[model samples]
Target: PAAALDTLARSLPVSPAGSAVAIAQDRAREKAHFVQCGVPVAPHAVIETAAQLAAVPADLLPGILKTARMGYDGKGQVRVATPAELAGAWEQLGRVPCVLEKMLPLAHECSVIVARGRDGTVVHLPVQRNLHRDGILAVTEVYEGNLPPAQTSQALAAAKSVADGLNYVGVLCVEFFVLQEGTLVVNEIAPRPHNSGHYSQNACDVSQFELQVRCMTGLPLVQPRLHSPAIMLNLLGDLWFTGDQPVAPTPPAWDAVLALPGCHLHLYGKVEAKRGRKMGHLNITGTTPEAVRTTALQAAALLGIAPF
Candidate 1:
């Protein structure tokens, strides 16, 4: 799907100025583009060949080897604990064009969804705290109280900065890494609705999808406002598997999950589920973080989701 999206996007009529090259489509290009726009990012090296991998500097050791494109949910990536692992990583990733990024200590991960009109007007969603398992998003907690005011301000400014720099005309999402020392670095940018913003459908005055429609159709952009504290759990295909095998998965007990208060369910309607596939999500809204977590935990147990 990632490859398909890229091909489809590239086939459309594009701007000669490179504005159509959305950073979200390619990690290597995104990092370079962010740097060109004066945004801070993790230190990394881009290598396009096995020779480059063999010559990688020792300092970037304990780094991650990532493909430049079509990598998502932690797929097409490998972790190298030392310089010696670089060659092995290159071999592991099939000697593709890639980035070797020093793994930084992260305090947490968060994402900000920014909507910009064709006229340059912009607005952002409430910052959301995210939890991931095996490179796939597991949960997103959102509310004004979920994120510290200062960090929220920083994340919003950073997201908007990239959107403005690209002269982006639709909903754009920026995933940020909050280091242990409290600095924020851009992880990547997405040109459309993101998993982290799914809670907005039930918890915000304006969802990212709605804003995207408005942006693309020349309508005025509306500032999104959070209506509740919410938590969203991504339902991946692993839930359908029996044990670790790919056998037909036991259908999740939908009735038990829906019985929870303020719990909303969304299924993608795909006929077959396979490993790492995104099937749907559960969004739980409540008056407080504790309440959101409590309700979401109940639904997770029913849906067979791993605990956050």
Candidate 2:
């Protein structure tokens, strides 16, 4: 109900103004906004009719078709490897409005979180290196050297430009795909604090949630500082299931996980366990990046998360 929320925001003190929310709610508008900000995005085409579908460029084949709205966590998307697959994919999506994005050779993914104030001030967190499973965020790593200095700078600048272009007045997360050739292209934007920024809770002096509050309450926005190297593993409900032929959900060994140095667990208290459901996250912090990585891997092992 982004549109409904946007309407409510017009009469309320919304952290993100309705205008920004409206843009982010629609892929067509979001991509247009990114281009208007001079940020690079993958080649794509909008398809809402048979004529438009017929007109799609051949170069955009081997692309992913994504619905224009209400799709997240890998939902409402289909991969089409050829022009012939376009119609079937679109039909499978119920003929909804969609965009076809040319698939790129991705080497990695990363994101930047920016907090912008009504006064036009923008401050950002360190770029986060991310890994996804089945199109859902699985892990996020933040620290010095997690990404090359140049790539980090590029991501930060592009994020700032997008926020400033929107005149956005809240925390915004800009996700990007790092091509094998080292080129960075904007993927999409989250209008509020995002999953990839979860590491900020334990690693930063000022977390993204605090930044949102500051923006909404008219408090001064302080640039967040990362005090420790951190890695965040998304806790999916799949973790609650244990052993072969288990009859019921069993809680993960939180005690064992917490025994490791610098491991912090945050559970959402989800009432049920279901595969692929985001239940919470584990944040690992340490004095050194190496120590954090080692501890994080150990925690992952205990939780059955694959090594990254």
Candidate 3:
């Protein structure tokens, strides 16, 4: 669909995004593009059918297989801990086109967002430290010096190289896996503003969303400045229910959250509250990172997300 959409965005000459070229260089194709452009990514194999499982190289075992399209939040993925599991995992995914990527030992995960114009100008924001739960974004933290300086610089440089290669226009997010040995491996690519960038809305002078709109309109791209340290806690539908196996959905009390100073709550107005749904997010900002993190823990505890 991304290829189709990219092609569609190409034929329409009237769009304000200056032809909308390279709005998305999707995951499956982006890997090849990255390798060609000298960007480093994890060892992977493209499996289009179940029979291809037998051909998987021995070294790439203990990997994860993912559907090439429409998969998100840990869905459409199966863990292949051993070679024998490959056949069952293939059948589980219904023999769809998938990418078998070897899972790397991680020190932490982070992301860098790039906004590019048709003229090839690029803009980047402060890298964000991301935490995930059940394969969904659980929290985002934006603070100076919290991440390893070497790894941060490496991710930024790699992201810019990829963006330059694609001639990408619009906001593009590159997620990275920092290995235990301190190597940066490109994990995936999101074609637009991503969950990790949402913290910029409260901490930076120019948000990723604003940058996206600017790029699409052919506006001048500016270097984003961070004004405050902040933490963004994702409010998922699980909070609305009592527990994992929730029998009835009940909204949690919002008083503690609303009462906290410097806490900003943004809820998506969705009618249903089914489990795993992203209901909203809470952004907490402060003059310092410690203050921001302390208040965020308090907020999380108040929402019953932590034992405290």
Candidate 4:
């Protein structure tokens, strides 16, 4: 059955074998040793029945009810803010088996993306401070450049430990909660070129996607180096044309961005769009974070979104 999924992926127009294997391995571990790895997962109790869900601790209210598999981007999830909300939430989900975890009161979120080769050498993508809207990843900025030296070292070490423990190959990401006291708590891991690392495509010598392909295919990694301070702005579906009729071409403000120097645009070849879907990204590289931020926001505004 697992091989069926692998086969299906390979049948697609572009599927890398090494990446397929890495993703499968990550899914297995997330299901198996999630708690053992010291991740601050919500307090969860697996339940197949409404009665079982009812039996869960009341304190865990305001928790998330989630399906164990195949959930992403705020799908297949419901928030139970109180006892009265439980029955309705369960019914809405069609009584599927689910886990309930305590709601985390997070201050800010960040992720460390790592790339590892078969020989076990690993490289970390710069740490990114992420912003989310309605549980969907919206934008990310390099956070390590702003961190105190000691804190930055701690974050990198924690990420390396996770990569080594998993014997992970290819690009992998570990999301974390950066508390007010400056402590980092593990959140979750994704074993692929993560959304947070998209900025590397233009800012670094080797992009996360290329690193993923290289690591899995046994090619030596082209050591990635950031040439300049960078920022990335996500373009959501709301910016795209709608309806069955062909829409008039309103040329994007690419000219203004291109003229700014060190600005690059990447549009994923997705055929259609809907609210909240990631359509593309604009990256800006400059000497300072302020300059990078300014350029990135300008580019996004041209595409009709709030500042990054």
Q: List RMSD in Å for every model shown.
A: 2.9, 1.3, 2.6, 4.2
lDDT of each: 0.83, 0.93, 0.81, 0.71
Q: Indicate which candidate wins on TM-score.
A: 2
Per-structure clash totals for the candidates: 1, 0, 0, 1
Error of 3 at 8 (Å): 5.2
Stronger candidate by lDDT (3 vs 4): 3
Best by lDDT: 2
Better of 2 and 4 by lDDT: 2
**Pairing residues by index, what is the TM-score of model 2?**
0.97
Cα lDDT of model 1 by residue, 1-308, tens digit: 44454565576622212443445667877898889878789999999966777777777878988999888889889998976677877877888789989899999999999888877899888998998889888999987667678788888888888888888878788998999988888898777789999999999999988988888777888898898899999998878875865476666888888888999898999998877899999889988888988999888887777777
User: Clashes in model 3: which pairs?
Assistant: none
Question: Residue 72 lDDT in model 3?
Answer: 80
Model 1 poorest 10 in a row by lDDT = 13-22
lDDT of 4 at 15: 25
Deviation in Å, model 3, residue 9 alpha carbon: 3.6
Which of the two, 3 or 4, has more TM-score? 3
The candidate, 1 or 4, that scores higher on TM-score is 1
* Stretch of 10 with least lDDT, candidate 3: 13-22
